[model samples]
Target: MSHITETLNQRGNRYGEFNRHAEITQNIKKAMQDSPNWATLKPWHREGLEMIAHKIGRILNGDPNYDDSWHDIAGYAQLVEQIVRPPAPPVPPAVPMQNPMRGAL
Candidate 1:
């Protein structure tokens, strides 16, 4: 076999995992949909979405940067975190005031 053919076969072996990238993208979308609010997505949320798109594009184009063994979906995780609410602030609850006229009734 030609050296070129050998290299191509090895490279093609990694393409099988391309679908995983698509799966990650789908999960990201689902997370976004499940979010209660869309108006207040943080900057990192947008960045993660853009990064996911870039990663998918890179994988589809056979970019050499993609790792075949490691399915790193940090972008998806970050986006989901943004979709979820931040931790609530700790504060004392306010008690409702009872109407004074109720005693007279």
Candidate 2:
């Protein structure tokens, strides 16, 4: 997921340009080899790790892309959109100690 996070961050900075998941996966594999802690990542987590790496790559390389292409990438672009262009109004914070079944309409 770190890879995904990194890719997402890059995508936001670059304003969405590239979508190289394979290269991202390679980076993630290298990262895992370098850091022993990466062994704990589950199989599912490893699934889209490349996508995340793409984001990191963009960040490292600096966002050279324009804003128009940001929405074009496949795989978790919506999450990227949220980071780049946040919703108009953030959802209201939940009330403390709110009963789960209180609103029995």
Local accuracy of candidate 1 as per-residue lDDT tens digits, 21-81: 5676666666765778644777767666656654554465455466732244564765568
- Residues 28-72 of candidate 2 have per-residue lDDT tens digits of 668865786657865545444545565455544455354332433
The 10-residue segment of model 1 with minimum total lDDT is: 68-77
Model 2 is weakest, by summed lDDT over 10 consecutive residues, at 66-75
Count clashing residue pairs per candidate.
0, 8
Instruction: Give the per-residue Cα lDDT of candidate 1 at 104.
Output: 100
lDDT of each: 0.61, 0.55
Please report the candidate that would top lDDT against the real structure. Answer: 1
Top model by TM-score, which number? 1
